[model samples]
Target: MLSSALKAYVNAIDDPYTIYMDTEQNSGFQEELKGSSDFEGIGAVISKKDYYIQIDEIIKGSPAFAAGLMMLDRVVMIGSGLTKGLDVNQAVSQIRGPK
Candidate 1:
């Protein structure tokens, strides 16, 4: 469950669903899960001139968000590194830290 403050913050966004996940359980452990892999590399899509970067959405009160990262902020750079040639998976891997 999301805290009230977090919910409020999500509600303030243009796309709150971007931060929400479905928790409904269709069956017990016996059933295979669907759409689980969909969350693996999800990120905000930002377009600038003809380039884009996927920004991993950190938690509500995280330093990233506090620094101005929104649901879909154009992630032009990660730290001192530019996101120019990195693919979505590479970018996500970098943002998620070491494996």
Candidate 2:
């Protein structure tokens, strides 16, 4: 399938920051990066840092801020899943959803 082919091509290049996202993934990724007032997820901006997902910013009055998460905090896990091998897109998708 096209998805697999795209993944294979990206993997061939071996760029951690270069990822292929499907339509839905791109939509969610855009929403998360835009800093919209009405947002889902933990209300924190994140990025891939080394082998982990790092929280770059905690939005004011959001669940993440309420939970006392700080900038540069490395997220090792999401629920029961480890974040070690996940790219930024995958991490964002996992983090975004209804409260």
Candidate 3:
């Protein structure tokens, strides 16, 4: 459909910064931009480093901070799933959800 078409167009453009986001992806992107609340996430900023995910920041008073998660802590797994080879967005989808 339109999403596929847009994705194809973006792929054709061969620009690393050009990406087509579907409704859910666009919503997530917008929420991240606004730093909005009411979502179900650990409130820790994470990034992929080498083959592992690392915590970059833990928001004050957030569940992550309450759990004693620290910046630079490596994430080995999420629930039953191993975090190896996961991109940041893949890790985020596993972490974030509707409350």
Candidate with best TM-score? 3
Question: Measured by TM-score, how close is model 2 to the native structure?
Answer: 0.60
Which wins on TM-score, candidate 2 or candidate 3? 3
- lDDT of the candidates, in the order given: 0.47, 0.74, 0.74
Q: Is candidate 1 or candidate 3 better by TM-score?
A: 3
The true-versus-predicted C-alpha distance at residue 62 of model 3, in Å, is 0.1
- Name model 2 segments beyond 4 Å from true: 1-38
Q: Per-residue lDDT for 9-89 in model 3, tens only?
A: 876997644555667656654565567775567766676657998876667787888999987799998889999999878
User: Mind giving the per-residue lDDT tens digits that candidate 2 earns over 38-93?
Assistant: 75777766766579998766667878899999877899998789999899778877
Ranking by TM-score: 3, 2, 1
Q: On residues 1-99, what C-alpha lDDT tens digit does candidate 1 reach at each position? A: 465465456557857344432232112111222334333322232222235674424444545556677755667787689988776556656665653
Worst 10 contiguous positions by lDDT, candidate 2: 16-25
Clashes of each: 0, 0, 0
Off-target runs (Cα >4 Å) in candidate 1 are 1-50, 55-58
* TM-score per candidate, chains pooled: 0.41, 0.60, 0.61
